[model samples]
Target: MKSVTRSLRVLEAVAQHQPVTVGELTKLFGLPKSTVQRTLVTLAEAGWLRANRKDTTRWEIGARVLAVRPAALQGSSLFAAAREPMIRLRDQVNETIHLSVPDALHSMVVVDRVDCAHAVRTFHAIGDTSPLHATATGHAVLAHLAKSELDEFTAGTLKEYGEETITDPGELRAELRRVKDRGYAVNHNQYLQGVCAIAAPVLDGDGVPLAAVAASLPESRFASGLLPELGRMVTDTAAEITARHPR
Candidate 1:
């Protein structure tokens, strides 16, 4: 417990002061040099901090730390509200169902999820970020954003997680528009090959998209002309969540 507190303290310090060396952090935190070094090493291993390869003594906040924020909404009613709907979607479609909310800068953080008992299941961690342009959940949320927001989000370079990832801005814009027109989204071997997912937006009381709910299954299971039915199931589940829980 003491060590865990120290680790969090180290992270807080690093987050406050970036590009600082271990010696400097030790002095600032008033901890021993050995203790600080060990903490830095452990944090880097767990993806909380990234060590400087050139200096080997300096550390910076890692991507994972930024990706997985401490659960600020822990024990919130949002998860409880979405639980039954997500389970019903999973059971109806016999696929993995998930709800993800937007996190910092182009990251979608998983808040709640339900999985099917099929021989093949889609495994996703609670706080994992699905690529924005390649995932149905991320696409559904992004599609509802205003034009300016979408432009800013896609202005920078895009990463291609799979062959079907939309790296071009024009192509991605077209896809988002299609999602808006259809009132749902679909991704086929985009983020991960052999995986397919369909999703819809969950709106708040103000009619703004607060989160996205998705059903994911392997392409083999969905290849038999079941796309329309799967999409309807996802859309209906999202609507149910939106109606039951107003953000």
Candidate 2:
């Protein structure tokens, strides 16, 4: 019984401080390293946690958690506010529209999606996660982060997803600055080859980013001439979502 209780506590801790190292968990719980590791392994085996993709030693919440609490993704006020706007954006661009929220400072998790009519449209499951430096949604959120938070995020390793991924710290910083100035971010086969996206941050009343709204489509459909128009449409939809969402 005590072991089960400990495992539950460890699971809660992992959810709160995701992408956390086992050593950090041990220190937080004041437990033996072996004991904490065992607890983590148990939770992971039970589908409550999974190791970070970039750093295997660190753990984050797993898909099963989302599967169990489906309402947390679709029943929230953010989803309610974003639904109509997302549908409108998809209709305007004829591309898949995604609403994603940051999972701590590591990754962005897709919370909702409005699919386009085209058979060749992009798709991301509700719980799909993507690196912050490798997707337009992630970059939009990163561009709105507070300076200290941005500094801390930039200090971490930027894992490369593909050749287009910005692995250099300086380059990423520059790109984020550009995103901040332009009110949106764009990705060209950065995270997934043959995929393209444009996104804008949904900011709260205080200007803190709450989520990002992105238009995702195939590379074949992402023409240079259409980028400006797509960017404007996406940013406008994101702004509408921000207005509709309660701060």
Candidate 3:
């Protein structure tokens, strides 16, 4: 019984201070280093935690954690705030819309979506996750990250998902700059070869991104000329969601 309780506590601690090291957890919990290390290893084996790719000694929440809480956002303020705006965006653009939140710095997890009527539209399941540097939804959030956080992210490997994926850190940084300047991000077969998307960050009172709102369509239906129009619509929807979100 005590062992189970200890494991749960360790899990919660890891979540609160994610990417935390064994040494830090030991000091915080007043536990032996071996005990904390053992609990982390156990949780990692169970898929509730994973070692940070950038620093193997630090731990963070794993994909299984996001996978298990499929309905987590449904009851939240962000989901409620985004629901109407997302639907309206979908209707206006006739493209699939997604509402996603960053999972630490590793990925963006889709929490809600509004599907277009198009038979060949792009689709993302509610719990689907996409790489942070390989999608419009991700770039929207990354464009607003604090400098230190962005640096940490860039320091790690930027895995390529497709030919358009920006594996070069310098190039990705330049793209983020443009996203910030334009108040939105655009992806043309960056994450998926046949999909294209435009997205904007939903910022809080302090301008920190809480989530991203995106409009996605099949690449066949997308054209370079549509960027300005789609970008404006997505950014407007994101702003509406942000204004409606509770502080």
Best candidate according to TM-score: 2
Report the alpha-carbon TM-score of model 3 versus the true structure.
0.74
Q: TM-score of each candidate?
A: 0.73, 0.77, 0.74
Query: Where in model 2 is the C-alpha error above 4 Å?
Result: 1-68
Steric collisions counted per model: 0, 0, 0
Instruction: Give per-residue CA lDDT, model 2, range 117-236, as digits (tens).
Output: 998889898767899999999999999999999899999999888899999989999999999998899999999999999999999999999999999999999998988889999999
lDDT minimum window of 10 residues, candidate 3: 66-75
User: How well does candidate 1 score on lDDT at residue 115?
Assistant: 78
Ranking by TM-score: 2, 3, 1
Where model 3 places Cα greater than 4 Å from the true spot, the runs are 1-71
The alpha-carbon lDDT assigned to residue 92 of candidate 3 equals: 96
Give every collision pair in model 2. Answer: none
**TM-score between model 1 and native:** 0.73
Which whole-number lDDT from 0 to 100 does residue 124 have in model 3?
Answer: 89
Looking at model 3, residue 120 earns an lDDT score of 87
Candidate 3 lDDT tens digits, 99-126:
9999999789888889999888888876
lDDT of each: 0.82, 0.91, 0.92
